[model samples]
Target: MNILHFFFGVCGNATALFLFLAPTVTFKRILKNKSTQQFSGIPYVMTLLNCLLSCWYGLPFVSPNNILVATINGTGAAIETVYVLMFLMFAPRREKVKIGGLFVFVLAVFSAVVLISLLALHGHPRKLFCGFAATIFSIIMYGSPLSIMRMVIKTKSVEYMPFLLSLFVFLCGTSWFIYGLIGRDPFVAVPNGFGCGLGALQLILYFIYYDKNKKTTDDNAIEMGPEKNPHQAQDQAQAQVKRSDKGSQNGRV
Candidate 1:
């Protein structure tokens, strides 16, 4: 049983690492294009906060030092920092100002939490406070993808939502839930339970709307076929007349 718990913990950490890094491809595109395009920096900001809180929660001051939790989330915080910097660099001035303001606000709030936890609280109280804070943030982070769900419904397309990311999130959640259950840690389990459910819903919506978007695209192409064919034929006729006229002039010459 102990071994099983350790295995699940490791798996959970691995999947969570993948989840944190999943946006690399999107950011890579943004970097290559030298624009933030349609991507928003808010989610990455929230994710960074989530990682910070999680890292704090797993620290010796807040709880037992779970190296797995600390390491992955610590790395997550670093990666998210890079992503947010890239976003700030490439995003328009208006968006950059907004994200910069939001980043400042997040930093202020996180600093307050750390100060409170370290200076005022200690031992079990500190653990409970930090644990609850982490759990709440994790739940919020899991639901961050709700915006994508709304877009999926509104556009009838899953193009904005990456399926593999959802899959990894679900897997990560499941692994953590099991690990928490076996280890008797509600703070870790509860949020992940919600995460699993939300991830599953996203996957279902993807499958449902994926085919609809494809069909709609195909129908639009078909509807435009006749409209394009006539224009194409007219252009060809004009080109043929020009060629014949040129040939006649050359013969006369």
Candidate 2:
């Protein structure tokens, strides 16, 4: 059982690390294009907050400090900071201002939470408080894809939703859920359970809509073919008449 827990912990940390770095592709594209496009900084900001909270929850003061949790989430916090900074650099003026303000607000809230936890709570109380806060934030992070799902349904397309990311998220959630359950950490388990569900749903929606969109596009092309062919034939006939008239005049000459 201890071995199993260790395996799951390592796997969970690796998958979570991948999840944190997934946005690198998006940021790379933004840098190449020199535009933030329509990408929002909210997700990265929230992810950073989630990492910070998780790090706090897994601190050495806890009965059994989850070094794996702390290490991966700490790295996540640093990576997310880079992502957010790049976003601010390339984002439009309005977006820069808005995201900057949001970043500051989040920092203030995080500081207050840490201070209150440290000053008011002790030992297990502090651990529970931080754990609960981390759990809530993790759940929010899992549900962050809801907006993208809504857009997928509305547009009948999944262009903005990457299936690879969804798959990895599902895998990450499953690993963490197993680790949490075996380790008797409901705070970690519950949110990851929800994360698994949401990730699976996103993948399902992607497949359904991807096929639908492809079929729709094929049907539209087929429908346009007959309309286009008749116009093309008429133009050819007109050109043939002009050639015939020119031949007749040349014969007369």
Candidate 3:
């Protein structure tokens, strides 16, 4: 069991590393375009907070036998920082200010957690407090794709959701979940269990919609961006109906 625990931890580390670094592709695009486009930087900022909390929770004093948790999350924190900085660099003025303020808030929150954990908590109490903080943020990070999932169902398409990203979500979540259970740490287990479930749902969605439509991924798909126009869907549907009507008229003539 001990060996198995370590094995999963290693697996978890690898997958989580991929998850942390997965945004590299997006960042590269941002750099090439010399713009952040409409991409939101909130996820990266929140993820950095999650990583910091997890790192603190995984400490030897806070939680024993979980050095792997700290190892991976610590690396994640560094990576997310870079991503956040990049967002600030290329984002438009409005976006730059938004991300800037959020970054400051993350630092403040993390500082509070650190202070309380060190001064007010000890032993199991410290673990529970730190673990809870980590768990909440981790779950937020996992569920960040909720908007994308909604878009998939509404459009009946999986084109916007990348297959590799969904696969890694499942892999990373399952590995950490198993590692946590074997080590008897619910902090790691619960949030990851949620993530694993979400990942499975996404993959199921991808398969269900895969190849079902020969049209482009954006065909009939609702706008999934943060600033979608509410009337866009109705306009798209009306346009589709008009096209059908025109086609029928031409066929008859």
lDDT of 2 at 169: 80
- For all candidates, what are the clash counts? 0, 0, 0
Tens-digit per-residue lDDT, 1-253, candidate 2: 8888889989998888878766666666789999887566887888888888888777787526477777788898898889889989999999999989988987886797799888998888888888888899899888887766766676555545666677888898999898889889887789999998888998898788885424322211111001122334345545655897899999999
Q: Which candidate has the highest TM-score of all?
A: 3
List model 3 lDDT by residue over 88-186, tens digit each.
999999989989999999999999999999999888899999999999999998988887777667766565666777888999999999999999999
State TM-scores per candidate.
Answer: 0.80, 0.80, 0.87
Question: Which residue segments of model 2 deviate by more than 4 Å?
Answer: 212-253
- Model 2 Cα shift for residue 195 (angstroms): 0.4
The per-residue C-alpha lDDT of model 3 at residue 67 equals 96
lDDT of each: 0.75, 0.75, 0.83
Two-way lDDT contest, 2 vs 3, winner: 3
